[model samples]
Target: MPQQSAEALTSQQKTTSRRPAGTLYRGREGMWSWVLHRITGVAIFFFLLVHILDTALVRVSPEAYNAVIESYKTPIMGLGEAALVAAIVFHAFNGLRIILIDFWNAKYQKVMFYVVIGLWVVTMLGFLPRHLYNVFNN
Candidate 1:
């Protein structure tokens, strides 16, 4: 038998390096969703800590609490609100997805991408109008 040429080896490597046939065991959509859920949950938890600290200032001194509240009543605070909303929405929707996965035995491993997209669209559409109304009115 003749030894394979370098060019032939390269071509063989390209074709044979195909993905393993199975349920994309790793780096699947469900895994990505799980990761995003954890990340957003942690971010939201950090924000909650700050929020609690700020509110706790009221117990220590009303003046300090009032100052923090006043700072939050600004355009920059609206951005914070948006971030909070996003985190909460992601957490809530993903939590529900998790529950569905458990109860219905759904194949979220396959549909997780669409599930996330749908969650984002529905959450934004549901919240945007109310947020805009409050912003404009107040």
Candidate 2:
């Protein structure tokens, strides 16, 4: 068997590493939406875990629970809560879009994806005003 020359090995490595990632991610909306969907899902899961633990604190003591809940009423926390609602909205609608693509029809994926985004936007617009009003007014 012949050993490969250093120059030959280096040339092969250059060719192989040229494609760090293929045309798979050419700024397509669908690809980005899928990525965001996964991110929001993971975030929601962690938030739910913390939320459950906080709710269970009522069992420990109602004052502690109220304290924790009250702590979430500040401007920063209100903004955080708004972002949470946005994440929840996006994740929920995207999940339904995914279901339609997987079970109902795959051909209308692009259109459905846009529809999902529109619905998410409408939902956020409807909720954001009320949520901010309550948060700020309280």
Candidate 3:
């Protein structure tokens, strides 16, 4: 038998005292924001892979790139284009907020989060109408 130090005992107690994983979900705003940040990050990674492939098409031939561009001109694809832009915008702003919280004293993190959200909304409102107009008008 080995003697466990007080620090080790306290750490073990903390780990075992937690609720089960399934029951741990509190559904708070911060939790939701964290989850969304991760989801958007993965989506952006996959989109980047596809974007790189499409960009490579231009090296193959102008016709190859033009074909890809022409396919993206559909109204349905336009909606997706708008969503892609939105995800990019949200991900970038949220990433900055995360960096600020991680590096700075961020005492008012919840209020800062609301500010991030407000900025996101304003950015979307400013861009979406113009994007949608370009989408349908083309």
Candidate 4:
């Protein structure tokens, strides 16, 4: 048996460490949608917590509750509402997709991605016009 030289061992280590050529990380659409859904759901949940707490202030005192509601009536709050709506829509629709995948055994993982994207686009298009109208009218 021949012992490898130090240079030969280093060369072998480099080759072993290098990734195989032409091997790309092909992430599935379903995986990406799942990640985004979890993130948005968490964000929406946090906002809901704050909203509930603020509304609870009304039980303690009407003035405090009114102040909080007045703050939410501003344009910034409108934008925040729009964001919350988006998050809810995404979470709901994607959750349905996940359910379908689980029960229906639909192998259309990539289709799930496209469906989520399409839903998001349609939702924004539908909501933006209404939001803009309200903003301008008020």
Task: Output candidate 3 Cα RMSD.
Answer: 5.3
Clashing residue pairs, candidate 2?
none
The digit string of per-residue lDDT tens for model 3 on 1-138 reads 245687788899998788646646564556767887888888889989998999999989989999998989999989988888788888898888889889996676777778878998999999999999999998
Taken over the whole model, the C-alpha lDDT of each candidate is 0.79, 0.87, 0.84, 0.82
Model 3 lDDT at residue 98: 86
In model 1, the clashing pairs are none
Q: If the candidates were sorted by their TM-score against the true structure, best first, what order would they fall in?
A: 4, 3, 2, 1
Per lDDT, the best of the predicted structures is 2
Tell how far residue 57 is off in model 2, in angstroms: 1.8
lDDT score at residue 98, model 1, on the 0-100 scale? 82
The positional error of residue 28 in candidate 3, measured at the CA in angstroms, is 1.5
TM-score, cand. 4 vs. native: 0.78
Poorly placed runs, candidate 2 (over 4 Å): 1-27
| Each prediction's TM-score versus the true structure | 0.72, 0.74, 0.75, 0.78
Task: Show the lowest summed lDDT stretch of 10 residues, model 4.
Answer: 19-28
Which pairs, if any, clash in model 3?
Answer: none
What CA RMSD would candidate 1 show? 4.9
Taking all chains together, the TM-score of candidate 1 against the true structure is 0.72
Candidate 2 local distance difference test against the native = 0.87
**Prediction RMSDs, each to the true structure:** 4.9, 4.6, 5.3, 4.4
